[model samples]
Target: MGQRLSGGSQLLITAFVHFQSSFIFIFQDYLEENSTSIYHDTVSIGGGSVFPQIQPQSRPRTESLDLNPESSLIVEISGAVSDKDRVLFTIHTKTTLPEFKHTECTVKRMHEEFIWLHNYLVEHDQYAGYIVPPVPPKPDFDASRAKLQRLGESEGSMPKEDLQKMKAELEAFRSLFLQTPKIWADSSEYLATFKKTVAMHEVFLQRLAAHPALRHDHNFRVFLEYEDELSVRTKTRKEKAADFFKSVSKTADEALRLTNQRDEDQFFREEKCLLTSYHAAVKDATAAADLANLQRKTMAENLLRVNLVLDNLVPKERLCTSEADLVSVLSSFFEGYQKIQVRLASDEDLKFSDTLRYYASDAGAAKDLLYRRSRALADYEAANRALDKARAKMKDIQAAEDAQFAANDRFKTISECARLELEDFKVRRIKYFQKNLVDFAELQVKHAKAHIDLVKSTLDRLRDIQPASSSSVMKEPTDSVGVPATERTVSLDDAFGSAVPFL
Candidate 1:
């Protein structure tokens, strides 16, 4: 395998390759015109003269001419200052280019400063609800030094072209806020104010750095490092929450399965059995009613034959009196039977089995609600466990490394917040289930009232058809078979025989 270059060297080589690619595009037209020659010595690949020098375009200076305090704010990063241990950057700002003095800074200090500027701008941008001009990234002093070392070059004796490129990049970085058209379009009024504020903040930071007492303070020196730890905690919290939701989603699916199973096992089974029993009772009742009607029609015909015989054979006055009495009894018996038979037929035809369906619905709803609550409780418990774990781990970390105490405190706060949210969810779920239970109870009461009213109506119908003892007493038929039409009188007790319990 071939030896690989370091990341720094690779970055420099990549930039070089990109520049060469652009050069190829620009020179392709010239090469096409001279295709007759297979080889050419004047084809400069680096920076020689395959192409003629082009004059630089002049741009009108847009910087303010007045030397006021706000307009005096300037910024630039000069080049690298390498040592045996680390590379330092030379920064220059706060005046016109000619008057600016260079200041040396380490990479770590510059990174912290850049982070401060970037974070402040981002926070303010969010508050204002618009984009702000962005700060340039910290200069890559170490990378530049490493690239130079790989090429057997020292910082003081770098390639002229590379030095020019670095200077150009720094110039662009300094002019980013003022020269970019996008910044002006985004928020014109805030641009100058933002620059002034950044300059003021930089001055304050410099003042703090100059103070002996505050220069070595942990709070001042470790802001960026602390922020990194906080960011890690935030990421971990989000991952835990995402995992919880994923697990709860699967629990919800399992709860749904349980709910459906309960419905099938309990209410659905009861409903099916109810329908089967009701239909069977109705069939048997209908058959009984048909038989009773047939018997009544036969009795009527027999009574009419007896009446005709009495009208022809007996003495006219006595026969007429006896015939009227017997006919009256027979008619009363037939009417009573018909009335009860009609009620039975109505009961069979109506088949009011809504109670069974209502119960099925109620049971299904209850099962679903119970299962949901069960799953929610499980999730709530899981959240509690997670919070406990976080708290325990935080305590361990806080004891293990004093530097992590602040991070542990933040994690503890996050865990407490999560716990509160879970408690609120549990409270809401309880309220919901309680309301459902109340509604279900009312539903049962309403069904019960309807059932009682049906029984009362049936009883009233039975009482209305009860025969009067003296007027419709039993009597023997004129035939010697000793049969009495009144003896066949149907009662409320007999009307419902073995066919009413399901109803």
Candidate 2:
């Protein structure tokens, strides 16, 4: 959490981020330029590769957040300080909805926590509780004896034991006790807390959005500091590297079991043998792959930290700044692009697997394998560009090498997969040319080299062979006519010249 000073403000501002996966698009004739209205949806938001939409999975959205008057759950809040205002909000918990399941503890938890809210609503029903969710839990605490017996073994155990055992256990627990948590959580139990809180917040946000007082008032804006998951992930990566490296010393590693394909001996020269299928599927890897998954699950404090930071800063940052003050105001915008880059980098890297498999099937095809690899190749180029950018931005942000990353435990099997596909395609293509289609095969073999040379010549825009060679990343331009190389130029007249002398 490094601090940077700006303007007259000496207050500390670490990296702040906001990512709105849930957005209500607004398009209005009255507004010349498109303006953002947080909760009020002029248009329902949907997501794909570019635009991420809101309502849930792949289809029609449940309810529109239209800013028009027809929208449900309108709320109005009035009188507050700037974005940094410390105004309290009351939320009633119990409500009857047909679709909602009557969960036990949540119902009771809601009743106890919002008793004051219920009281406040009774007196000032008009606006006090408008922000409360439409479908909230009924009062009940899920502490059944059978429930405790079944669900409480791993987490709910521990005899006070002896003093040393208690101290050691507590100490061990404290080591990695609280880290990156889920996105949404109250002081409730962990089972389904994150989803519940977000559901409740959605309704509240909608209601507060429509509130006449909030909509009209300039000062009482409901500034939302959306959590960008990047920071948590970034910190997670840093922590893993630190933890793994900090305690371990440089040790001579054991010999790795790699089939040395290049090592030729007096014994034999054979083509590489590839496995038909990988045994320990990447999803079941015991080491790096598993660790990565565990990291995703155990991320705890960072999540909480981001939410609290958001809660504090959303109101504060918006007070004197406009959204246009991107880098000038919020640091999230500065760091977020890196996250986006990393995501793209990761996807491109995975896509390399696809590219390898497809090309292995048939690299000659202009459309199928070659076209698909175009994206992969572009990703490689993009990765280079992104690396340069990141390195320029941050002092020492080294990008993981594509080749090395591809060789990681998760990706090693992809090689085997590609190899099998390549063998099959080669056999099928060669067999077709040799037996079934003699004329086609002969023509293909004859023209392949010439066609490849022509294509290369056209690409290079030179008649003669040039000194400058293309990157080996692309497949070597092949023979236009056939499967084999025929680089030596031969004249039929030379062989017959001796016989022709007598004639």
Best by TM-score: 1
- What residue runs in model 1 are displaced by over 4 Å at the alpha carbon? 1-54, 57-72, 78-91, 94-109, 124-127, 138-503
Top lDDT prediction, candidate number = 1
Q: Estimated TM-score per prediction?
A: 0.18, 0.17
- Candidate 2, position 393, lDDT: 82
Candidate 2 lDDT over 1-503, as tens digits, reads 12223312212321111111011011122122422322133343443232222321231122323223343323222111111111122222221322223211011112222233322332342322122223323322233223334334534354422222223223322222244233222122222222333333333344334444333322112122111111211236876687467425211111121222232322111222221121122213324433553343333223333333333344443433322122222234222322233322222222222223222322322112211222233344555666667667884454434533433422223233333444544554354334323333333333333333333333232212122111111122245675644344322233222211100
* Candidate 1 lDDT tens digits, 367-427: 3333333344344444555556667777554333443443444434433433343343335
After superposing candidate 2 on the true structure, give the runs of residues whose Cα lies further than 4 Å from its correct spot: 1-115, 125-135, 138-180, 184-190, 213-503
For model 1, what is the alpha-carbon lDDT of residue 441? 43
lDDT of the candidates, in the order given = 0.36, 0.29
Error of 2 at 338 (Å): 38
Backbone clashes in candidate 1 total: 0
